[model samples]
Target: MNPREHIPVLLEESLALLDIGRDGIYIDGTLGLAGHAEEILKRNPRARLVGIDLDDRSIRKAQARLQPFEDRVDLYHADFKCIPELDIDFPAVRGILLDLGMSSYQLDTADRGFGHSQEGPLDMRMDDRNKLTAAKILDKYPEPKLAQLFREYGELKQAAKLARKIASVRRTQKIESTTHLRGLVEEVCHWIPQRGKIHPAAKVFQALRIEVNQELQGLGEFLIEAIGLVGPGTRLAVISFHSLEDRIVKHTLARLSRPEYGDSVIDILTKHPVVPSEDEVARNPRSRSAKLRAAVKRPHGS
Candidate 1:
């Protein structure tokens, strides 16, 4: 599948919250294919955008997709966590957006190894530059540490059992492919027969991917830094695909919204996350799990 065919999750809700100004400067922290960035620029032709992504493939695709707006868009091949360190000349950022879900391109590409249904090597690094891969994690991590990773990142109930299964199996043979790992998970945690039930190995795959990419490690730090880059009344919107990511965005915005948390830097705009409508979800099944949370920075004195 081409990057241009990828549909962004919660596009309308995020853009509504951003309230794009004609001459405003915005940052798309996870510029996967520039889907949302293109919409933003389309809505406000005079606005400028800074798009950042860790995946070189995404940067290349986004650059191509946004080529028409090259004069107004600056694409960077960097992690969103480095936003604060960026030396851009924008007077003040008017908005920031981070869609923390794996792009469809990443999941659909068999060699990228983000999906279990595909027969590929168990390499789920978001950035090809990252040395750690899911295969390496499974091969090297001990039973106890693997259990912890599954429990914390995946929230899997049978984490210990799955870890023990991997530990026993890996002693004689390495778990090098997505198929091998999926089989191990199915062996330990039998699949439920209920309709719409998620795959038995889904959570395990998520845990390994998170561990390999350190996706959750610097998330809070990045949110804080992104907030700092914007001025009072500027908005920030984050669309997270899973509960773990949504929880982080929810709590970070909450803390910033509270008066006790110093300047009350942010005022929560959505008390509950904005979910996609039935029509949108029908058109894009991948958007079903998305949760969008937005907040506006309070004026400095207020």
Candidate 2:
């Protein structure tokens, strides 16, 4: 409901891998509401932070939340993909963190359209400057393309059936609201509420959100470039929510950890992803799906 209530998923696990005691900058690429950034500053007296997020609302809240550490922080209003272009002291960077999950604040805000549980329009744009929207995709995409999207992004079994359903509905009425589209998805998937079962509308909304924000497009490339930019021993931690994103992070880290030119660039800290414990998941249900993977750049010829 508020910034204070936002729990940074995999908080202690990420901080441990970061090894944040050194005197340098820590970059929170997906700052959200500065949940992790605040902790980093609070716990590591020597650490300064560079926090970046696409959501202006989150950034403003983060800025307010981080006011005490303003002198040690640099807040940016941009995408984490823009990390390579930012004016950062690469050599002095201690660690970098990217929590790829959508912030709770964004999901809680109805107008953002990140949550199917909430009734709102089909905006789904993390950055307001972005021209694409969930409604635009629904309105413009052909049935086949929509099917492909639902299948690939949402992994929905009834992709074609749902796409066909949307095609039928949009002819007479626009798919403008989150509730409107959610109801259609439920209808196509056959509405049934069962304990512990994820709603089909949640998958549909996730697929739309990914498409609207291009969430997966530049993620792997950014990780590779970022690892290449930082100095040896600089740590990187990523918390990805879905399998689509976790796959990218896993493969990218794997590739980087492999020896090339007689030297591996990074050492994968977690042979497998570090997931949240059942206790944390019980406390913050949104974090149940999170997977955290970390790596550190290796010194040359080692």
Candidate 3:
């Protein structure tokens, strides 16, 4: 997929809240199409950016898209959760941005198995390096384990019933594709009704994607480690698409900025999250679900 064609949701709002510095070090933790990184680099000639993404396709596209800024950007083909371990050493990172969600390109590609509307392999690993795929989980995971995953990740009301249906169907044939799984979900979730804003398979696909990527498992640790890298005067911004991810970012930033125990080292910048304006939402409907939260590192000792 071409990088320039990718329109990142809430781009203007994100840059405004991040407050990019001219000579600062920055990290685009989820550099989907490098759309945000491109803007950050263009804003400041001296600013250096470390762009990370687990998806190889995104890395390739970003590498090509951000080529002109080679002097200031270093691309990493790794998971965002491991950013703290990357070798790039800047005295202090000016800001870090995490835009956490499957990019539109990924969903639109169809072969990536991110969207249920398309027919493709049921492989939902954002990073192809990851061993677990949605198909493997459906075929191998125990019914109880699958039920738990659906319940926790999808917040689906009928997780147990859905899990049972998947288990039974998989016994007859491998659930090898998105269409196959969608059909199975419809068979099991008859109570969801035929009419609604969202497709009935939406929750199931969402659960599988979360489980395949381990999206929530290491998020808390990742956020804690990344925030600690910000020096005084630096800011951190996170754009989350759903409540599950938003809650994680909200609580993690709050904990870092809170000043109860012996003076905190950070201050919450956005008491309320910065969401897309009505105009932006109208221009790009995808931006409607985005919620951006920001915080800044406090100077040492009050």
* Best of the candidates, lDDT: 2
Whole-model lDDT values for every prediction: 0.87, 0.91, 0.83
Instruction: List TM-scores for all candidates, in order.
Output: 0.96, 0.97, 0.94
lDDT of 1 by residue, 170-268 (tens): 889999999988888887888655789888688888999899889888898678766766678788999999998888888888888877776548999
Shift of residue 228 alpha carbon in model 1, Å: 2.3
Give the Å error, residue 147, model 1: 0.8
Q: Give the candidates in order of TM-score, highest first.
A: 2, 1, 3
Q: TM-score: which candidate is best? A: 2
Q: Give the C-alpha miss distance for residue 232 in model 3, angstroms.
A: 0.5
Q: lDDT order of candidates, best first? A: 2, 1, 3
* Candidate 1, superposed: residue stretches over 4 Å from native: 1-4
Off by over 4 Å in 3: 1-5, 191-196, 261-264
Better of 2 and 3 by lDDT: 2
